[model samples]
Target chain A: MPGVCASSTQSPLEGKVSKVKWPTYLSLSLVAMILGVLLVFQFRVVRYIEQGVSLGRVQELTVELRQLEKEKLKLAAEASDLSAKLQQAGQGQAEAEKALEGELEKARLLAGLVPVTGPGVEVTLDNPPANRGWATSLYVIRDEDLLRVVNELRGAGAEAISINGQRIVATSEIRWAAPFINVNLTRLVPPYHILAIGNPGNLRSALEIPGGLVEYLQELGVQVKIQAHDRLTVPGYNRPLEFRYAKPVVKE
Target chain B: MWLGVWLTLLGLILGVIVGLNIPMVLTKAHAKYLSVAVLAALDSVFGGVRAAMEEHFDHTIFLSGFFANALLAAGLAYIGERLGIDLYLAAVVAFGVRLFQNLAIIRRHLVRGIKRG
Candidate 1:
């Protein structure tokens, strides 16, 4: 059957080659060409898509967060039960101990160990959607971008600051962990929601300073949204903190 | 046999050139569907070649199959995206499996032809 093409003219009939019909080659060639084009196009498109945090990764983290929340609830219930037992045992405590309890409550509020609510400003940040579909990492929001915003807010007398609902305390950290940022040792995804308790106008103005954090981010193709709110509540620091080496000095 | 292989190579090179010169911009979303469509197209092309070798070549069926399969797969992918399901994966798997099957058939034909020749 394959020899039928050998009888035709322009068959390159010098050899016993299995000559297939020319139509087959022509059609396959066109399709192969389309395939080649798509291969390169898909390759370039994948590179751009992978440049940002993928949806699958975010979903994985969300699953982890849900599991951790369940464990946290279980732990919190156990802690409360233990605290109740201790309070029952410490009934009729001395006046000195009662006074110390009051001091501890004041310390907790000052140390950001409890949630605080007041008039403040909220700053949200995310990289602007690519306009040309070129490099994305170059214009993305970095850890330093977030730090600059936080610093500017604090400089403007923000009493309490929370990033993505993770309270910022003396030991809190805001740093980069490629493809995502970390706050208080917890991974935070964009768009970063930064809430600060302070004079709303002052906090907003601090970020709005010419060539300031907000402006700098905006220039880098980062979407920066700032709004002053009459009331904003910053979450409390939930992670346990332990001081092992530091001790108070005894005063003579 | 060698002429057909050379034509395929030439077509691929020409395709790459045209694809690069073309001003079409493929976003990340469209890129996914393109990959699946490419698989479908390759599958149809191989199926056509196989049919021709078996003495039943029909350009009408081959062309319709190529375009219709790609469009159907792409449409399925779009629906999957809106529904928040990875429905494109089904198209990917089905086309991918058929593509490999067709390639294997072509390889057997080439090997048998070489032995006979």
Candidate 2:
């Protein structure tokens, strides 16, 4: 304020225009102005150092870890309770059954009969809706296109995969039957979102590698979005398993 | 004070506003050098102000000191990095000490001038 109305605040020494010049004022004020901007930047740097993850981000991450820990505790308690019951009922047979039960649980997970949740990647595939022109179906997503993506995900060590909520197991088939793609006998509507549970880095790189399925789909006018998640839940397979002709061969 | 000093300040404010809105910002990696440069600028500004009050302000000396302090502080920090040491700490302390000393002298000069008047 004082500097703005120069004459009113001008001291006796500064009144000598012979001593004070335009350059001094210009340089000083310019330096002060630059200092203001640098101050703001320095403030930002200090803030980032103090809190790399800003407020409201830590809670959600802790929630996922908490859920996983709860499940682990539940499993351990069940194991301990079962062993105690078996000890009361008399002994070695139940011990074997307990181990077998653990194995069965793992197999059921592999068969996609149980709901699973973990860190994973979600992929969404769609066709550009605005460009629905003549012979556009030729450029649309096909069963083979989906198959290629599934194949790539599997190769990248994906433990579980689902297309449009349909889990892909050993017997699941991806097929094209005129105007729609089928996964496990269920027709899918685009945009087809595929969720794969695996190392996110590995899964992303598998699909996004140069000239890979995602790029190929893009070339065919199919839009693809791949995102990694800290906690992704895939629905359990709803279809029943039935076997009549095929029988399990037993060891002699 | 120069008549156009306000214009220089206005230009600086406008430049910062426009540039920052354009999302031009120093990243975290550049913070180390930026902090040192800021300290150097602060020292130069104080020194300049003291010289101005004593009626011996020289543009060449002021500008040269400004750039030299910034570059030398940055260079010391770089050399420290190469030698696996914290040489920038020296710049910070040296500048900090000079800053307060300059501030005290400026304050004493102001007090004497006010009492005389």
Candidate 3:
């Protein structure tokens, strides 16, 4: 297996060297070259395929949304028809009463005039102290905290909400930057204002709900105000909905 | 070409894992040898598949196909790895190259057939 060339032409030491070294060097170099080329080509292909897969996923989601909208319309029409029949028979008193109750609740929430309920405390978080430590500087408002607050607010039946004067929408984002946080891209600093246009009385208590974020923040010495604003108005969804990828795809 | 590419990818992955796990066995020199052998094997597989598909009927066809495929795969794979690229991407390029080559050959054959008719 040593360097035995065709026609049996090999020098003595050269034969041993070729047998032991040349084969290894040649094989290794060849493999290295091949691997390099393949890697380049494969990466390009993978990128192309990944883009295609992402597009396909978006198309699939669009189809699902269209199906859901059809179902919603069908259900709404059925409910309206049933209500009309009940009214014609003069047997819609209970339904009418319920509707009135709903309207009254809405008006109260709109005026921010609801009483607080349950046992909860409020702790408004302030900017880091002037003599803040390194850790405190890094303790800026994070996306997780904003998400937590929103989840808790919804759970507490918060009728409406606003952060730093900007109304919270379905697709609002609370992005964090250096020392500042954004509520739908509007920047604000401590003491961060978060207005809940709900039953102020209920909201005061909701803010202090046990096993809640407010309690945790209070322990951390964050300042929180839970005052009942008799005439606080939670601004409506004023921001336009911008769907980068959620638009319906019309199939030809 | 496609088969060759896939084989190369499989070989590359195998080589990487084996090289990492058995570091004791992977002398720089040994690694080099393994790289070449793996690439060659992958290429040979592709050539064999192509020959089978085309129904080429020479004695020693399998040996010849294997040698040719191995050499081609090794050549392409080396180019890919040197560029810090992925084996799969390399395989894709190899496939494209092979496809184009075959298409050209087929076109010539078709033209020749038309002339005879």
Candidate 4:
């Protein structure tokens, strides 16, 4: 071993004195253990960040979201079935039943349960030209603009409305979800095309009113275009609308 | 000398398996510190290997160097982050240069051993 060390080393004293001691073995092993643990931790941390998910929280949330969606669909189906049964039970009173059915249809339209088509206006809101070199804040259409436009349309007697194909139900929310606008929990990008089912003349006049939402948005440098169409179709709400707490009073 | 390598490899394998199975001890916030410390530890390991090859390996020096270097590197990184300076880059470059230098020395010793054998 000494001869081999001598051959391996440049200096002879180094060859003899640097013999591997027992304590050296112990310390090296300990260092090796630490290095090993650190390497593993580093690897795990990198993987976690890259995957963008906590150890189990993301998976748990995803499972929960899916389960809730399923429950909502089931409850919606059950509600529709009960309504149909109520309509059938009232078949004995013909005139009252017909009037009741008509009222139910109007309610369904208002509730965004059925798609509707009529003469209405389509309002398109877009960011101003990119060459303007203005800050995003200057040209971007904000959530408040969308909410005001929707309110104006409803005030103009719009029976139904849809924004970017997402039916704007009574409970639909329009707000900023960072980078995009969330309507009915669906992310929408520019340019937003808002289609309102109403009298085209009335909707256009409502928007063109002095100091109204359209003017306010235009002043903010947002491009606003309102085009009235002879016919426009608004889709039914796609998401399950479950009324968990609202129960109908039993008219005994 | 080979015994040290074997023990390190075993420890590494055991660590990986345990790390995979066990819950994470470190949080995302400490990732930068861990990275700098790992680099420092690597530099020390290579330095140890170089010392072994040169026949001047000291147990106390290697042990002290390992812990001190790791802590110092991590500390520098933490302080740099607080001070809004990238001090980990300095640690990385320094340790990286030493690691390569030690590797080169170890390689030379291995080549000499092979020729003699």
**Predicted complexes: DockQ each:** 0.16, 0.08, 0.02, 0.17
The better candidate by DockQ, 1 or 3, is: 1
Q: How much does candidate 1 score in TM-score?
A: 0.41
Q: Residue-wise lDDT of candidate 3 within A96-187, one digit each (tens)? A: 78889999998754543444232322335564454555555434556566667767776677766667666666667787775677777878
Whole-model lDDT per candidate: 0.79, 0.77, 0.53, 0.82
lDDT tens digits, residues B23-96, model 2?
Answer: 44455556787788779777876776676677666655666676667777777887887898898899899888
Clash counts for all predictions: 0, 0, 46, 0
Residue A215 alpha-carbon offset, candidate 1, angstroms: 1.2
lDDT of candidate 2 at residue A176, scale 0 to 100: 90
| Quality of candidate 4 docking, DockQ | 0.17
- Please, what is the TM-score per model? 0.41, 0.43, 0.32, 0.42
Residue-wise C-alpha lDDT for candidate 3, range B10-98, written one tens digit per residue:
65565555444432333332233244444444444343333333444121333334345445455555665677665535645554565
lDDT of 3 at A239: 55
True-vs-predicted CA distance for residue A75, candidate 4, Å: 22
Q: If the candidates were sorted by their DockQ against the true structure, best first, what order would they fall in?
A: 4, 1, 2, 3
Residue lDDT tens for model 1, A142-215:
89988888899999999999999999999988899988899999999889899999998899888898978778
RMSD of 4: 35.7
- Estimate candidate 2's alpha-carbon lDDT, on a 0 to 1 scale: 0.77
Candidate number achieving the greatest lDDT relative to the actual structure? 4
